[model samples]
Target: MALPTGPATSWLQRTGFPSQLFETGDNDYELYEAEDEFVLSVEMPGFEPDEMNVSWSDGVLNIVAEHEDEQRDRRETYHRRFRFPKDVAEDEITAKYTNGILEVRLPVMRGATVSGTEIEIQG
Candidate 1:
């Protein structure tokens, strides 16, 4: 059996940005693919829905959020980082925050197909 070659793997290798950032931390994401839609659930804490920004572009999803210190008597800094997927639609992504967790829901287009090439066999 031969191996499958795709751009997704090539893109990851060429990017060369430590993949550790993308998979580090207790924060996790779950993707559910169904016949009708795709659901993405990301666990984001300490941020309100309004404080976060979600956008999709060029088949990539981007999420940005800032956390401000509530106490005037102390100063705090964000030392954590995250790596987002590279093939999400930023314009169609939707997010909502509740109970210290941010939930993002993205609907996959009905007829959308994964970007790749099909191999034909010759007898």
Candidate 2:
């Protein structure tokens, strides 16, 4: 079978970095922008809702999870590391987990420019 061109071809030709490789393993995410809010979707497989921690601090959204050690006697091996984006507001972030997916909604702050009109005064 053949693949599409343009962006898909570019993505295929480029060599992935360490972070990109790690991101593909266990960290799949999506960001959506709307008129009033920004949504972030994170794919967390094989993890319970209670086991993950979501927080926003200093304009950075941090998501962390610590898996329980299944074997207490033997040491475990680490495979990958995923890096999250650091451009989101931490204080305005809210998250919910259902069906093995974590969805976070962040409300846009005030100070955005909106169209308006000024009334003329008649003398």
lDDT of 1 by residue, 1-123 (tens): 633333235455455422233324454666676554456666666666666676665555566655554453222122332233334444566667667665666666655667668789999
Q: Write the per-residue lDDT of candidate 2 for residues 1-123, one digit (tens) a residue.
A: 543322323444343212122223334777777776678788777677777777765555677764444553222122222233334444666889988788988776665443357689999
Q: Which residue pairs show collisions in model 1?
A: 55-90, 56-89, 56-90, 56-91, 57-90, 59-87, 59-88, 60-88
Residue-pair clashes, model 1: 8
Angstrom error at residue 16, model 2: 27
Which regions of candidate 2 deviate over 4 angstroms? 1-27, 69-92, 113-123
Predictions: Cα RMSD each: 12.1, 11.8
lDDT at residue 37 of model 2 (Cα atoms): 66
Per-model clash counts, in order, read 8, 1
Q: Which number leads on lDDT? A: 2
TM-score of each: 0.55, 0.54
